[model samples]
Target: MTRHTLSVKSLRTTMADRRAARRSRQSLERQLASYTSESDRIELDAILSRHSGAEANELRSIINRQAMDRLIRTGA
Candidate 1:
């Protein structure tokens, strides 16, 4: 409709997308934590803790990949 209304709608959509991404990231982190040992989980949490914004998501993806790789190699 109006320009202002369109801008508001876009902002709301962007916020929703960010929230959904955050939830997905959290779920992935939880799954990764479950797959690792306590010491490794602590290290993973430390790595996962130091990042925020876009880098946080990227770091989480990297951690997930690494965990999967370890599991594959270990056959665990």
Candidate 2:
């Protein structure tokens, strides 16, 4: 492939990745909002805003685990 074609392909992949990430983040935020109190949601949003990349991923993982635990306990 030509250099220009390669660059275009890379850009398209990057854009798609970003869109997927955004959707995932929004879904996680909605899950948190549904499960957390208003104060806790606010605090969580603040923490998310302060972190990005791997730190953010770790936070999301922790939140997901807690959410799963709650669901299991409630049989939901």
Candidate 3:
């Protein structure tokens, strides 16, 4: 597989992992109900948000590079 393929696969996995973590955190929040402290929820949200954002940026970079490659190959 191309390195690009590997990167996209990795990005997909990272996104999946981020989804699972956020879901788990949300479930925890629901379970806590009136018992949840604000700090704990904020921490969980922050962690997931950072990871998801980084993965998205990486994917965007990869996609842009691929697009540029196509343009150059076509002499455009």
Per-prediction TM-score? 0.51, 0.50, 0.45
User: Model 2 residue 13 lDDT?
Assistant: 100
- For candidate 3, report its TM-score: 0.45
Error of 1 at 20 (Å): 0.3
Off by over 4 Å in 1: 38-76
Candidate 2 overall lDDT versus native: 0.77
* Model 2: per-residue Cα lDDT over 4-75, one tens digit each: 999999999999999999899778666664656547756876888788898687677767677677779899
Top of the candidates by lDDT: 1
Cα-based RMSD of candidate 3: 17.5
User: Mind giving the per-residue lDDT tens digits that candidate 1 earns over 1-76?
Assistant: 9999999999999999999999997887666656467587678778779877887777677676777888899998
Candidate 3 or 1, higher TM-score: 1
Candidate 1, residue 36: Cα displacement in angstroms equals 2.1
Sort every candidate by TM-score, greatest first: 1, 2, 3
- Please give the range of 10 consecutive residues that has the lowest summed lDDT in model 3: 29-38
Misplaced by over 4 Å in model 3 are: 34-76
Give the candidate number with the greatest TM-score.
1
